[model samples]
Target: MISFRPVDVDSDAEMEMLHRWVTHPKAAFWLMQDFDVEQVREEYRRISEHPHHEAFLGLVDGNPAFLAERYDPGHVELVGLYEPEDGDVGMHFLCAPTDTPVHGFTRTVITAVLAWIFADPDALRVVVEPDVRNTAVHALNAAVGFRVVGPIAKPEKQALLSVCTWHDFQSATSALPRLGASL
Candidate 1:
């Protein structure tokens, strides 16, 4: 089963693993490509201390599979990054590096992440701003019910802003098959 739990980024081993994941070539769009070990540690330290954001390490059958964060866009991610609307909560996820692409793994990870975010009573919508060229992630986001709003140009890259409201998400995905369950 895929699950998410609060992570203790203060742990040395966890920090090391996170550093490797963020710096991996496949994670290039994550924007930490040139990060050093110390920088990674410091970044986690900041996240751990931030009040508006919560970080979780996603696990599948006790194996680390991804990193996820849930935060208020008005406070952290979309502070000066985008024009945020009320009830907007930003989401970020990074899948761990793997040589073999596991079928349905990304879908499961995204579903698990969205489930966790919407679990909060105050969360009305989930917003994501991924690189416009990241077609893989755009497809995954759509699978979870997010629809594109428009594109925004950032200093680092052009991003496609997308949102999935609680009601829309519920309606769109209600009949969709989950990765592990038999259709």
Candidate 2:
């Protein structure tokens, strides 16, 4: 079963685990590989305290398995990053490091995150800006109902803008499989 809870970044072990995940090679696109542990700690602290964003620890069968965050595009992630459109919400996610990748894990993680976001009364759409070169995540995002809106040049890299409105998400995923029995 998969579930999400607000992360307590001040916790020592959780912070350490997050540090390792962000520094891993699989997390290269996250653009935090060169960050020190303290930087990661500080980043999490800021996110935890940010009013327009939220960070969550995802658990599968009671074990921490992923990290997910949601932000209002007009506030945090897309603040001056893009021309804000009404109802735009941004999202970021990173799966825990694992030697053996499991089938359907990405699908489950995204589904759980989407479920959580849709639970918010004011949320109207989900948006993502992943590096265009990250095909794996592009596929995962598409699986979860995000349709590419085109590429946007960023200071760091070219990002593929994708979006999923509530209606589109509902229509596309209505018959799709959910993450686990818990979802």
Candidate 3:
């Protein structure tokens, strides 16, 4: 079984682990595949300091296995991309590269992410802007309730802007665990 818990991304040790995950080829969609350890550290450092953004390390039973980010779309990633709703939140996630891929691990990670985000009392909807080329993620986003609003050109890459309301997620994931369940 897989279990996920969130921890702050403040220590050098945590940054080091995240650097490896973000720079790996599997994280190319993350657009940090060319970054060195220090670059990764610096980038996340900025995120941590930003008032509207945050980064978290996801541990699978105490070992880092994924990264998740939450941000205010209105103030940060999508300032002009779309109209900002009162309770809209932006999100991004990356699964750490592994030699042995666990079946449903990625799905589990996404479900946990959505559940965690929606758990926030002020949050009413979640937004995502994954690279348009990332079809695998598109499918995963769909599975978790993200409804595409079509492609939009960002400074970095073409993104498929999508959103999911609380109802959308709840309706789409009716068969999944309620919350606080292990993967």
Candidate 4:
């Protein structure tokens, strides 16, 4: 089963693991390619204390599998960038990089993260603004029923703004096998 625990400041070791994942070439859009462990920890430290944002470590069968971040788009990352809906939440995730990647692992991680978000009764929609050049995530987002609203220019990159409602996610994933089946 997939579970999540809030990320904390003392999580240095876990931060190291996260550091490696984000610095990998496959995670270019994550924009932490040059960050060291301490930098990562400090970054999360700020996130842990932020009222509008929180981060979690995703565990699959009790082993850390990925990092998931949830935020209030209206107050945090997307503030003034998009029209805010009452129940909208923003999300970001990074799956652990592996030498022997399991087929469908990344998809499973994203599905689990989406499931976790919608589990919150207040979450009516999930928002994402991934770097426009990240084609892999654009495809994944589409597969999971995220519709691009348009492009938005952020300080660091030009991003494709996407949104997914609970109904859309359910309809899209219903036609497929269960998310965790591949793992």
Candidate 5:
């Protein structure tokens, strides 16, 4: 089973791992290709300290397997860009880079991340604004029941604004294959 723990400034080693993952060519959409470990650490440290945002480390059998961030869309990522609902939460996730591929690993990771988000009792919907060019993530978002609202231009990049309600997620995943993970 997988679990999530809050990210904190003490996680230097995990920060290094994330630095590598985000800098990988496959992760170009992360937009941190040139970030060094210190830069990555400082960036996440800021997130960890922010009141409206949070970072989490996804653990698979106690080993860090991925990263997930959740934020108040009205306060942070989507502020002034989209009309955020009262319980809308913004999300970002990154699975660690690996040379060895596991069939359905990314899908499983995303499932875990979504389950984690929806677990919050106050959460009414999940919001995402992945880079417009990130087709892979677009498909993943759709599989998780996200419906594209439109494109929005942000300071960093053009992004596809998408949202998923709890009912939508339930409907989408109910018919799909189940992946095991507690998140």
Candidate 6:
């Protein structure tokens, strides 16, 4: 089972683990490959301090497997980028790199994360602004119900803004296998 907990940036071991994952070549989209451990600590510390933002560590059957971030679009990431609506929340997730790849693992993780987010009564819709160049994530997001809202320019990179509502997610996952059903 996949579960989540608040990231404890104060823990050296956790920070080290996060550092290794973020610095890995596959994490280019994460934009922190050149950062040292302290830089990661500083960045996550900043996130931890933000009122509308929070980071979570994802665990699969008790071992760390991914990281997810949740933020209020109205108050943080999408502030001036676009108009924000009530109950709109922003999401970002990263799976740990592995030597053994599993088909549908990314799908399951994202489905789980979105489900987790929707569990919050206030979260009616999920938002994301991933880099346009990250085509893999675009496909993954589509499988989970996100609809492209067109491209938007950000200081860092051009991004594809997408949104997935509760209904959209439900419709998308209705025919899909869930976490415990052999996937």
lDDT per residue for candidate 4 within 53-164, as digits (tens), equals 9988888898888888999999988888889999999999999888899998888888888887888899999999999999999999999989999999888999999999
**lDDT: worst 10-residue window of model 4:** 174-183
Residue 73 in candidate 4 has what lDDT? 95
| Model 3, C-alpha of 26: deviation from truth (Å) | 0.8
lDDT of 5 by residue, 1-183 (tens): 788988766777777788888899988888899999999888888998899999888998889888889999999988999888888999999888889978878878888788788888899999999999899999988987899999999999999999999898988888666544554
User: Could you give the candidate ranking by lDDT, starting with the highest?
Assistant: 6, 4, 5, 3, 2, 1
Mind giving the per-residue lDDT tens digits that candidate 3 earns over 1-183? 334444345577877788888888888899988887788888887888899998877766667778888999999999998988999999998998999999998988888888888888799999999999999999999998889888988999999999999999988899987656232
lDDT digits (tens) for residues 1-183 of candidate 2: 888888887788888899899999999998999998788989988998999998889898999999988898888765566676777779998999899999877777788888778777677789999999999999888877899988888788899989988787877778976554232
Clashing pairs in 6: none
Put down candidate 6 lDDT per residue, 36-121, tens digits, no spaces. Answer: 99999999999999999999999999899999999998888877998888999999999999989899888998999999998888
Question: Where is model 3 poorest over a 10-residue stretch in terms of lDDT?
Answer: 1-10
lDDT accuracy of residue 58 in candidate 4:
86
Residue 25 lDDT in candidate 1: 97
After the best TM-score superposition of candidate 6, give how far the Cα of residue 70 lies from its true spot, in angstroms. 0.2
Q: lDDT score, residue 123, model 4?
A: 98
Candidate 5 contains a number of clashing pairs equal to 0
lDDT of each: 0.83, 0.84, 0.85, 0.88, 0.88, 0.91
TM-score sort, best first: 6, 4, 5, 3, 2, 1
What residue pairs clash in candidate 3, if any at all? none
Report the alpha-carbon TM-score of model 4 versus the true structure: 0.95
Question: What are the models' TM-scores?
Answer: 0.89, 0.91, 0.92, 0.95, 0.94, 0.96
Clashes of each: 0, 0, 0, 0, 0, 0
On TM-score, the candidate that comes out on top is 6
TM-score of predicted structure 5: 0.94
Per-candidate Cα RMSD to the true structure, in Å, reads 3.3, 2.1, 2.4, 2.5, 1.5, 2.5
